[model samples]
Each structure stands twice: as C-alpha cells, then as structure tokens.
Target: MPMLTDTIKEKLSSIQGLVFTEINNYPCIEVPKEKILEVAKKLRDECEIDQIRDVVGVDRFTKNDRFECIYNLYSHPLKIRIFLRVKLDSKNPEVESLCPVWSGANWMEREVYDMFGIIFLSHTDLRRIYMMDEYQYYPLRKDYPLMGLPGAVQLPKK
Candidate 1:
C-alpha cells in the first residue's frame, strides 16, 4: 500500500493548490477551499474513488485557519482509502458542497454544518440536521461550554 500511496502522492503533487502530508503513515492531501470541487471531480472520475465514507470538521482555534473540513474517500476496486482536507477561515467557514460529486455527502455535510457551523455552498438543503432550527451555536467548537450554555438549558417552546 505504501507504493500505491507514493504513486498517488506523486500523481497528485502536480495538481495546483495541493499540499501532501501524512497522518499515521497514511497519505493525506490538503487542497485550497476554492479548488476542492475540482479536486473532488478528479478524484472521483480518474481515481475510482466511489465512496465518501465520512466528512469531518475540525476546529483548532489556535491555528491561522481555525477550521478544517476533512473528507474520507474509499475505492473498493482499488482497496484503498484517501483523506482530503480543506482549511477554512475561522471567521467564515464555508466551502463548495461535494454532494454533486457524491450524493451520500448531502447528509454528512449537513451534520458537519450543524456541529461546526461550516457552510456548504450549493448544497440543495443546507440546514441543521441534528439540532433544532433555532439553535444558535455550534456545539462542537472548543469554546463551547462543557455542560451547557445558560440558554441551552431552557426547554423548547411548545
């Protein structure tokens, strides 16, 4: 698998706005937010990545771009998995939706948005899936209180 990883790294390195890194020995690619849709199209059309296993959002408040949207993709025929990441500015964490590339990403992107407040551009329905519509804050951020906020304890109005 290392050979395949190296080959993929070599192939993707030439793509503009792509930066490669390794996590737990697995190759991960970082792409500019504006180029994510183009990159996803390439990964799906050319690399046989058929499944988007997961979409995760991370908030590292100390970093320059405090938010990251991560995608885990799998190719069953190739028997390989790949990670793609896009760093987003803390002030406006928004990126183009991948649901166009992978239909399964619709709900996954909503979940990330609900938890991390990251907006998905061009998503058919970008709304809170887990939390109520009136919920005001993203719960997964590091700054959120452990127990609950003052207003969070109030029961929803009937």
Candidate 2:
C-alpha cells in the first residue's frame, strides 16, 4: 500500500470529484466522470479494495445534465471500503465496464444502464433486466412524470 498523505486526500477531495464521507469507520470516495476508471483502478490496485459489492445509478434530472453512477468496493484483506461515483451526461452516459476488474459488476452495471439509461461502455452484454422489452424512458429519472402524459386516456372508474 502506498503512503497516504493528507495532501493526497485533500487533492483527490478537491478535484470536484467523488463526494466522500466516512460512514461507520469507512472512507468512501467519489470520482468525477473523467476520473472514474482511474480512481477505480487506484482503489483496487493501490488501496486494495478488491471486492465489488454493488453498482447502481441515480437519476437526478433536476441537475442540468447527467445521472450519477455509484460503485461500492470492499477490501477483504484490508477490511476497508470505498465509494466511487461518476457523473455522466444523461443523453449518452457511458463508462468502461468494471467487470474486467470485478466480474460481479457485469450484471449490476447492466441493470443500472437498463433502468436509468446509463451506459456501460465496454460491457459485453448490456440488456434490459427488470423492465419490458420496449420501454423507452428511464423510469427512475426525477423528470419522468409517471402519473400521466398529455391526453392520456381517461379510463372509466368502476
């Protein structure tokens, strides 16, 4: 493990990248879009975060443009944890699949892409999981008004 410095921590924190927090004695880190993969590699190779717990996407349309991809990694040997986040453009959010590093990420990333419209760039098979085959809009987006659309058919009540 490399020597961690306060400067390095502050530098990574100040990059406008990776919102971080210490939860229950774990240091969680978030990385910006451009540094997502780089940070992930570091977490695994340098910091020894070798376990992939989950990958998920959050749709926040209120923001100007993009969804946030959340990655959770754990180090079995070191007993440490990390949280990685990447901001991607909503229109075409994409990232290299982390499956190459952690096979567990494959299906999780795909599910996130399917539901939130985020794309995993190098995923071998990115397909819809829970939703219907032809569903278009991302159901999780804040702006995805699900109640009704203009001129929606008004069904008679019983």
Q: lDDT scores for all predictions?
A: 0.89, 0.70
Tens digit of per-residue lDDT, candidate 2, span 1-158: 22333333644553554566554555656566776766666666755668899887887764455688878777897665566766777667777788878888988987897778887877888888886666666667777687835534444589
Off by over 4 Å in 1: 10-14, 153-158
lDDT of 1 by residue, 3-108 (tens): 8776676656657878888777667889999999988988888777899999999999865899998899998989888899999998888999999999999999
- In model 1, where is the ten-residue run with the lowest total lDDT? 5-14
Structure candidate 1, residue pairs in collision: none
Top candidate by lDDT: 1
Q: What is the C-alpha RMSD of each candidate to the true structure, in Å?
A: 1.8, 5.4
What is the Cα-based TM-score of model 2? 0.74
The best candidate in terms of TM-score:
1
Global lDDT for candidate 2? 0.70
